[model samples]
Target: MRKWFIERAPDRDVLLKSRWLAPVASRLAPATIWQFNRRSIARGLALGLFVGFILPIGQIILAVLFAASIRANILIASAATLITNPLTFPPIYYAAYRTGTFLLDLVGGARAAQTIAAAQPTGIWTSLSATSLSTFVGLLVFATLSSILAFAAVHLAWRVSLIWRWRRRGGTDRAVTRPTIHQEPPSV
Candidate 1:
């Protein structure tokens, strides 16, 4: 798992030489960003989801920047941004728009969406309306709630897994190792 995070994060050597990352280079150089711990992983995953959901583009860079500032796992944050890729983009946006519209209505200021069809349909980008404000609001709300939920979920799951592992190890705090296949020497 640590190796997985290491492979995703930017190398320390590369950070010192990159012009784009120069501003945050010194901060990211420390092993803190690469630490495979609970808080970092949780923060990284939550930060990545928040940035990815809130913005359609620049998710990876934004995740990295936020992770660096917040002391989250840089690589995990970067990888988590993939949650909002091409395949999942449209549906997620549409859902966010709907959520926003619903929330706005509940706020007692329902903005009636007027769709003046311009020789084309808006598809599922909205709730059958032309209201970008609602979508934006929904995105903001969605991002916040999602990130919070993700953070809690990660922490809870981490604790549960640890307990499960400890129990499986005969109620002891021992690292379980998988058995390796024994290879017999060939007769010369």
Candidate 2:
């Protein structure tokens, strides 16, 4: 029964693995990320870090999907790490930590600060200070966001390019064969 289900249902690994994904992914049509030009895709991946940092949630999942769809190398997809490098890690995390703390405090009332510190004792004591928490959270958030965005952007560019190529080819064919309805009929 378990084997049957494994074969019938979309397993998590199967869904996650790009090669295995081809069959189901085919439904994505001409917009597939797999169809993208390699150099362009690589460049796009490199540039996506900027967008990733600004995006909300850990949207790097989208980046992975995009990379898979575009068939761009996973290395390029993971390159959003450029934004979270050693130099920037401290500042970004510090900002996120402060933002999260401030936001939490605003919602949790005047006692929010003391309560959070107390509740997540180890995290607070070891790493959640305004000075440290930002770095920690920044690292976490940057990793999460970049991965998601790179995948998404790569996939999006691939899909658009595929559709555009198809349309362009299709248009040229149509134009070449199109007949003029306004033309006079041939005489016998």
Best by TM-score: 1
**What is every candidate's alpha-carbon RMSD to the true fold?**
10.5, 12.4
Score each candidate by Cα lDDT.
0.80, 0.53
Q: What value of lDDT does candidate 1 attain over all alpha carbons? A: 0.80
**Cα misplacement distance, residue 85 of candidate 2 (Å):** 1.8
Off by over 4 Å in 2: 1-74, 106-146, 183-188
Give the C-alpha lDDT of model 2.
0.53
Q: For candidate 1, which ten residues in a row score worst on lDDT?
A: 171-180
Model 2: lDDT of residue 141: 59
lDDT tens string, model 2, 1-188?
22453355434444445775565555333333432354545544643463345444454555555555545533344455356556875577667766655654566632544656567756635343543444444545555566566657666876787799899989989987877889787789
Clashes of each: 0, 25
